[model samples]
Target chain A: MKKIMNAPDAFVAESLEGLVRAHEGLVTFGAGRTFIRRRDLAPGKVAVISGGGAGHEPLHSGFVGRGMLDAACTGHVFTSPTPDQIVAAMDETDTGAGCLLVVKNYDGDVMNFEMAAEMAASRHAIDTVIVEDDAATGPSLRSRGRRGIAGTVVVEKILGAAAEQGSNLAALKTLGDDLNRRIRSMGVALRGTTVPENARETFSLGPDEMEIGVGIHGEPGLERTRFAGANEIIRLLGERILAEFPSDVAEGGTARPLLIVNGFGGTPPIELYLAQGIAHRFFENHGVVPARTLTGTFVTSLDMAGLSITLALLDEVQFKLWCAPVATPCLSW
Target chain B: MKKIMNAPDAFVAESLEGLVRAHEGLVTFGAGRTFIRRRDLAPGKVAVISGGGAGHEPLHSGFVGRGMLDAACTGHVFTSPTPDQIVAAMDETDTGAGCLLVVKNYDGDVMNFEMAAEMAASRHAIDTVIVEDDAATGPSLRSRGRRGIAGTVVVEKILGAAAEQGSNLAALKTLGDDLNRRIRSMGVALRGTTVPENARETFSLGPDEMEIGVGIHGEPGLERTRFAGANEIIRLLGERILAEFPSDVAEGGTARPLLIVNGFGGTPPIELYLAQGIAHRFFENHGVVPARTLTGTFVTSLDMAGLSITLALLDEVQFKLWCAPVATPCLSW
Candidate 1:
């Protein structure tokens, strides 16, 4: 693969080191560089921690700072972080209130973070919330349930704000579960990503083909279809996500949705914005009024040329929390 | 050829429309949607305007808001904005304090922006400053001088703050010129971008080759060398940029440079951060200390798979101005 990397094996560690160095004022590395935490942690506030593979950047790590995640445990590309790393993140960021672990719905990630929570329970109050907002997989087919995709960003943001506001561990856990139930995401990949160590693309497709409902780890998408226009692609993804919305959120009553049109790494901002325009129209035609819209590359699948649309049904309090200010390297408002 | 776009010809306009829609609170479109201006413009502050081809996103358009460019005119992908678009931007953003036009050094860009300045002069005071900080092309070889690349972002940030602080048209122009002279940039491309209209890659390279000193518009670099490690590649680009620094700035006596490691769309954050770490070490070995560093995809060449490094030699005044707070959609620091 043609990539700017010193050594394939050193990709994850070096990238984390660079992240710390680049945002020196905002974050620092824990002992052994297993985890990164904000420089200044508010005393007696619940610490929010989340992490997974290194490829989907600006996810767990980039969201670490004052208004978002307290710490993020990083792992190798498309690989889950070790339980020890997650434990270190928990230990480093725990102030006194407790720690909240935001784990995505991958088997490896769920197990690892759960193991870390069990390991750290004696020392501090620890809770793990599994985010299964990916609506790509059918509910009954997979034992692991829905895979977590870009909706993790929405979970982290709202939960981070709630944690910062002195919410207890139980309260944060409830909020996370509620938010995950309300959020739905689906992605379409135009190309697969090349892992640093592989030196080749993980998967291949025909020139005129595109993968719909693709997972973030370069997993096979639900369907491989001929490439279509931007609006058509967005409509398929949007309809799938909208159809999966909880009954209460799906009804066009008083619910206002927060839309996230996320690019999978390689897509440029122009395309993301174009997708957002199409998404706005899509929602409008469906008789839904989106309250807040976020369009950018928040979560990515390392150099994958694709985009995902996430719709999070927000209540008044949730909308306020979503609108709350955040100060992180990748996200600042 | 895989991309998320509707019609190739409608790409630029549709993208701009999405930008205005996404950041409706911060910006609005002109009468013909040729230009976008800040929603709230200070009555007496000098207006800062910049524009060029559409492919290099977040460069001229994303920087339009509170403390950055008052307006930005956009053109078709890799094509210069027409004089009419530039004139519309100038006319819409001009206040009693006059307007400052920041143009990158390109034959078409310079000619068109200059013509727009002439056309807008009768209605309001207008001044133009050309940015030519690309050190890849020698001064004597190209009639238009060094091509402007990522340094244009630096010029916009520094001058945007100065303009917001009530700097007049002449002062802003001088500051832009000084900042432009102090900045130097060079890039490398692993792959070329595919413009929507073309529906194919702009250029092609061998499997194990990379282009050094590549232009933002997918132009061939100064050399096509075998691919190397990240450190080696960064070292080469850094050395070339450092060697061409003005003697005064090169002395490194109390000069705190601002470093920008920009991605050309397709490069992921992991690779960009890895390159940043290597850049830091290269600067340390060369006895140069970068006071501030901004790393992300600030300037991009559509979906090109490569990156560019820009080092702006900043003095105390410029550094302070850089630190000043500004609220824009893409940049809010």
Candidate 2:
């Protein structure tokens, strides 16, 4: 587990500098930190901002651009960004129109971003949208508040596109709520990732085993499962997400859904695509038309060797917003 | 190594199906994979087409979309697409504006794409641009031509953006040639990635050691060296690339270049970003200003545990084009 970092502590700061240097045209920031807001922020448009730990490359920060998030706060690898940093990003990207804080369902993310959002709301008219789409871990009741996973990208993109299209703060919140109703995600990890500065594995998983319902922080999944083929894996995960679909979409069967085949960390695009093939066939066989799809590393769990699937059931307007141009690093469609 | 795949042979076809299904609005293909092109190809733009082995996730196909590649020919994992498939892509995407083929410097990629281009040239007046930017293996002038690595993205993006702006085939070739002169890439791998179906590692290095200047196919590199810190690694690779910079850009003591910190399959984005940080500091210390930077799994070697760096010396026009909008699945900036 050798790595090429200078020092464990300097890793985050140095990485941000490099990111800014590379994307100078689309990004700019205050001296001394990683919060780079989108270059062209309009005063009248509500801003969407999100961030978390640093390990998930292109997640919160890389997504800060047009038709996506307007600002991102980067924490240390696997650690939540401080509430102060989140507040800084909110302030930097905030125009008179207000801001939207999209927090993942993780305990750290929820607490930190919520605190920042509350702080912002006290100072300004900032809004918030919490995404909790993970369907893997649950007691299916009060404890079943879904953990945010790769599906956060779909939510952010939809909401961001709506925000870009002059959706007012109230309109944006309605769109965000609509996005929440239509989205569900689940993931499994075959292996754990090594933190570069640590020069060691973050968590341990049996080489021959995989865990379904895995979270991004290398959190233990609901259960350890035997390795299976792509089709079986998709069927197992899809069944859970499908069960969560709204009765109208499932019963009426008139609306089409957007599919997202998201790689966790180290899984190759080839494997993700294979999993996607299975998920697509299963969804199509269920008479649900997939109107739009995104396949790539949207939200990742460091280098966890697995993937997640997100199904965003869309209305006509949501479908149109989903197809809007996005200028993020990893996503553009 | 556990993988979520059905059969080794079925990986490519299944992945393609999943890709198109997921990106339903952006991509379309014929049955039996005869032709695959973006849904947004305009009326008379010069089609920019390129392809090789299937392992590179977004290279030939992930890049197919508006403002980027018009079409791409995909083959089996790490295998070149058949001539018939390449010819079909050319025919479908090529209008009277002609087409430009961007082939990597590998023997197989060059041979296969050249053959397809020749086949297309027999009927349509098509031009080709061969990129050879892996400076670690070149500079002897007599040795086998330089190996192409991550620099392919720069070339493809510039050519694709130029084509999107309605550049003719000849103009696109000129831009590609200029980029070839400016770009250089080198890769290091800690371990090799296994083929999906077989789960057999393609190339081998020691657990604690790394190979520099390796090709994408897990082929032997120009050197086998002990792993060092990111600064030292970037210094070594940067020195090699800087040696190849054109005198005009390198002369004014302002040789600002675009940086690409690429992951060779297994390397995580966290480690890649740390490495990019070190690489940036080293370049700045050496009197080089980095104009643009991208760090991710642009071209991969399955799940090989490694990273590659590409430095493309940027002129004014190149910098502007690099900052241009590129709407591709894997990369967008």
Candidate 3:
């Protein structure tokens, strides 16, 4: 493969090493050598830690800094972090207050983080908040509940802000869960992803086709539709997200929703801003004017040509929390 | 041809429209509609304006904010802005102190910017500092000299800070030229770029090969070689940059160099950070520890799969300028 990595097995460690080295003042490695923790933790503040696969970068890892995530545990490419890694993160950031795990809705992630919370319960009071805001999938007990995607970033930002204000672990968990319910994200892929270890692409598409609602792991989406113009494609994705979004804050002009136009690695910034424009206009016409729009490759799918749109309905409290300043490697606002 | 654009001919305008809409508080379009000027210009401060082809985004337009470029004139993709566009930027930003045009080392750009400065001479004082920091090129006068790449960001940043500090037009120009001389940048492409208007890739490589010293516009470079491990390839690129780098600051520990690992759009953030780690260790061995390493897709080639490393020997004066606060749409420090 043409990946710029030394070896497939060393991807996680090498990547983390580069990250910690590049951001020496903000983050550093923990005892386990996998998870990252803030170099200087806030005294008596609830530690908000999150982790998952390694490929979707700047998510859990890049968000570690002063006002965001206190620590982040990373696993192998597309693999969930082990319980030991989670507990280590808890130990690194937990002061006398407590620790909160911001887990995604993946089966492995949820289960592993749960075990880690139980394992660290004696040392630190622990709580769990699972982000399951991917509205592309239906919520049914039979199916693996709605898989968390880009909306996890919204949850983390709000929860991290709440925790930074000295909210207790249980309070932060409640905020995270409520914020997760108010956010929805959906992805569209013009091309599929490939694992660094594999020498071939995991999936391929026709010359003029895209996968709407594709998962971060190259999972199949709601449909493999024909390629369309930018406006049409954005409308399709936005409609799907809006359809399943809760009515309690559907036309959220009260506090004004936050919209994020995230690129999946390969898409250019020019296009992401274009997508943000289409999203803003479309939503404005639908009686929802976003208070803020973030456009970047904060969440990615390796180096694939794709993008995801996230809509977070913020109340007065959540809106204030969203406006809180964060100084991280990937995000600065 | 899978770009998220409505029409090929409308690429530049649509992209700029989206950019202006997304960052309404920071920048807006000028009279000619091809240039962008800051929303609230600092009174009596020297205005720094930069522009070139449109595709290398976040270069000119993204830097148009509070403490960066006062104005940015954009042209069609890979095409230089016309004299009219440059004149419009000059008139819009030059508030008695004077205007500085930061042009790249391209024939079309230099010619057009010179014409614009001459045309606007009677109205405002305009000086120019052309950046030619691409080390892959030889300094043969006949040969187009060196094409400016990611190092343009360094020039803009330093000059922008200098301008903000009330440096006169001539002083800012001198700083810009000196900063250009102190910096050297080289790019390696795992894959080539494609113009959206064109339906095919501009250049292609063998399955196991890469293009070292590739230009931002898919220009051929010094060598097309086999792809190697990250460490070895970083060494190759780093050595080339260091070799052509000046002897005055060859072992610059006194003022500490600033190293930038810039992505060519298509490379993921994880790989870029990995390259930064390699660059840091590699430069440390070479007796230079960078005062700061800003790694990101600051300047890009329309989502091409590649990256460039920029090394700048910053004297104490310039080091302070480099560390000055900057708040822009794409860059913040």
Q: Which candidate is the best by lDDT?
A: 1
lDDT of 3 by residue, B34-122 (tens): 69889989989999999998899978899998778999988888889999999988888888899999999999999999999999999
The candidate that wins on DockQ is 1
Clashes per candidate (backbone, < 3 Å)? 1, 5, 0
What is the alpha-carbon lDDT of model 1 when measured against the actual structure? 0.87
Which tens-of-lDDT digit does each residue in B37-112 have in candidate 1?
Answer: 9999899999899999999998889999988899998889989999999888877888788889899998989999
Model 3: pairs clashing at backbone N, Cα or C within 3 Å: none
- Give candidate 1's error at residue B286 in angstroms: 1.4
* Candidate order (DockQ): 1, 3, 2
Model 3, residue A194: C-alpha shift (Å): 1.3
True lDDT of residue B93, candidate 3? 85
Weakest ten-residue segment in model 1 chain B by summed lDDT: B248-257
Ranked candidates (lDDT, high to low): 1, 3, 2
Measured against the true structure, the TM-scores of the candidates, in listed sequence, are 0.98, 0.88, 0.98
Candidate 1 local lDDT, A227-295, one digit each (tens): 988889989998998889778767746376888999998898888888888888898788776788998
Docking class of 1: medium
